[model samples]
Target: MLITFKSKSSPEVTMYQEHAERILDVLNKNHTRGVITAAEAAHALQLLEQEVALSKLHPEVDAAHANHSHAHHLQDEDETAEMADKNHIGFAQRAYPLLEMLRAARDGGDNIVWGI
Candidate 1:
C-alpha cells in the first residue's frame, strides 16, 4: 500500500509504504500511520535535511546503516538493489521534496497526516 502525507502548508507527497516507513523510522517514530505535530515534523525535517552533515558528525548512524545493508549476504541483483535501497545516499536524494514539504508544514504550524 501507498501512504499519502498531507499538510495544509504544502503539496501532498505520496510514497510507497516501505519508503514511508523508512523515513518514519529515521525520525525515531513508530512505523505506523498517524498525525504528526508541527513540532515533531520540524524536528524530523531538520534531521532529514541534515542527514549528510549529521552523518559526518555521527559516524555511528552511518555505521549502523552500513551494517544493516550488508547483513544480507545474498549476491543476487535483487539483493543488491535492496542494499542500495537501504543506503542513506539514495534515501537522502529521494527525500528532498518530502523534507521541503515538512518544512513548509512546520513553518505554517500545520500538522502532517498520513494513511487516510
Candidate 2:
C-alpha cells in the first residue's frame, strides 16, 4: 500500500515513504508476536493525510474569508471552514483507534515503530 501526505501548498500528495518504511520495519521485526499488516498502516496514513489537508485548508479558507468583501463568498467560506474543522477533528478521532492498534502491536513485541 502507498501512503500519501496532503498539504495546501505546492505538493498536495507527497509520498510518505519514511513513515511507510518505519511501519514495514516494525512489522517485519514483530511479525512473530503479531502481524501489523500493510492495510492497517495504509488506513492510518490516509487518515493522517486527510487531517493534514484539513488543517492546511482551514487556515487558507479563513484567510480568504477575512480578505474577501463579498458577503455570499464569506458565508460559503465560513461554512467551508466549519466543515473542515469538523473533518480535522473527525480524522483525529479516527486516528486514535489506529494508534491504539499500533501501540498494542508494539507492546506485544520488543520492536517499536518509529517516525509515525
Candidate 3:
C-alpha cells in the first residue's frame, strides 16, 4: 500500500506504507487514515523536526532503527554484512517530502490528509 498525502499548500507526496507507518509512529499518529489540520501543523512539524534532530545526533541509532525489523531475518553472513551497509534510507530522507508539505501547510493554514 501507498500513503498519499494531500494538501492544498503543496504538491501531493506519496510514500510506501512501511515508511509512512514509521513516520506516523514518530509523530504519535495512527498508522491509518488521518489528517494534520492547519491548526496542528506547527506541533506536528515540531515533533518531526525533533525526531530528525535526534536522528542526526545519533546517526547509528537511526540506521539501526531503519533496519531493525529486517535485521532478524538475516540468515547468512552475506545478509548480515549487507545489513551493515550504510545505504538504508534514514528517517530524515523518508520524512522530507511530508516535512515540506507540513511546512507549506503550516505557512498557508492548509490541512494534510492521507488514506482518503
Candidate 4:
C-alpha cells in the first residue's frame, strides 16, 4: 500500500506504507491516520533530521530495515538501480521526501497529515 503526506507548505509526499511507517516510528509518532500539528511540527522535524543524520553516519544502525527489506524490489526501479550502482537507500534516502515536508511544515507552521 501507499501512504501520502500532505501539508499546506509542501507538495504531497507519497511513499510505500512500510516506508511511511518507519518514518513515523522514527518520529515517535503513531503510524495511523494522524496529523502533526503546527505546534508539534518543529519537534518532529528535528527528530527526523536527527535520525536521518544518524542513519547517514551509521548505516549499520538501521538493523530493523535489514529484516524489513521485502519491499525493496517493489520500490522505484531507478532508485533500486541507483542503490545497487552507488548509494544504498538507507533510512536517510527513504526519509528524505518526508523530511522535506517536515521542514516545510515547520517553517510555515502548517500541520502535516497522513492517511487522510
Candidate 5:
C-alpha cells in the first residue's frame, strides 16, 4: 500500500511511501504464523495510516485541535476524575469490559478477538 501526502500549495510536497513487501518482511520476522488475524492486521494497518496522516498534519495544526485527531488521548486524568464523580456506574460499565478484555488477553492462550 502506498501512502501519499498532498499539500494545498505545492507538487514538491513529500509523499511518504511504504512498500508492502518491506512491511511483510518485518511482520514475518517478528510475529508467529496465525498470531495476527486478518481483522487485527487490518486494524493495525488502519492505525498506522492514521498515525502517518496525523504526523503529516501535526505541525500545521494547533495543539488543542491536534488532540481531536485521536480522541482517546483527550481523556486526561481530570476528565477521568470528573467522570467518576458525575457517573460512577456509567463509567464502570464502560470501563469494565475493556479492563476484562485486557486482562484476558494478557493471561492468554488464544489471541484477543476484537469486533470489527
Candidate 6:
C-alpha cells in the first residue's frame, strides 16, 4: 500500500505505507488514512527542522552505535548493521518528502490527506 499526502500548498508527497507509518509513529500520531490538520503538520515540521546533533525521530540509530565500544562491532553484527542502515535510510531518504509536505501544508494553511 501507498500513502499520498496531498496539500494545497505544494505538490503531493507519496510514500510506501511502511515509511508513512514510521513517520506517523515518530510524530506520535495515529496512522489513519484521512485528513491531517495544518496545526499538526506544523508541529511535526518544527521538530523535523530542529538543529540538533541527533534527531529524536530515530532513536534506533543512536542505540545501534551505543551498544558497543568498538565500531567494528557494528559491522560484525548483522542486527546492528541492519539497524544502522535502516535508520539512515528511514531518516534520510524517507523523511525528506514528508518534511517538505508538512512545511508547505503549514505555510499555506492546508490540510494533508492520505490514502485513496
Candidate achieving the largest TM-score: 3
Off by over 4 Å in 3: 69-77, 83-86
What's the TM-score of each model vs. the native?
Answer: 0.66, 0.27, 0.87, 0.78, 0.22, 0.64
- lDDT per residue for candidate 5 within 26-86, as digits (tens), equals 3342211223343354444444444445545653342332233333544785664454445
Order by TM-score, highest first: 3, 4, 1, 6, 2, 5
Q: Relative to the true structure, how large is the alpha-carbon lDDT of every model?
A: 0.72, 0.40, 0.86, 0.77, 0.34, 0.67
Best by lDDT: 3
Q: Name the better of 2 and 6 by lDDT.
A: 6
Candidate 1 residue lDDT tens string, 1-116? 77888889999998767657767877776555787788888788877877746666776665555455555655686666566556645455557778888889888999988875
lDDT for position 81 in model 5:
48
Per-residue lDDT for 1-116 in model 2, tens only?
A: 33432222213222234324333343343312233343454454455455546645676653343233233444576775655555433323433434544444434432223223
TM-score for candidate 1, please give it: 0.66
Looking at model 6, which ten-residue stretch has the lowest summed lDDT?
Answer: 62-71
Q: Please report the TM-score between candidate 4 and the true structure.
A: 0.78
Per-residue alpha-carbon lDDT of candidate 6 for residues 43-114, written as tens digits (9 for 90 to 100): 777666651225446666634433442245556677765656554443445678878888888888888887
What order do you get sorting by lDDT, best first?
3, 4, 1, 6, 2, 5
lDDT for predicted candidate 3 compared with the true structure: 0.86
Where does candidate 4 stray beyond 4 Å?
63-67, 71-87
Query: Comparing 2 and 4 by TM-score, which wins?
Result: 4
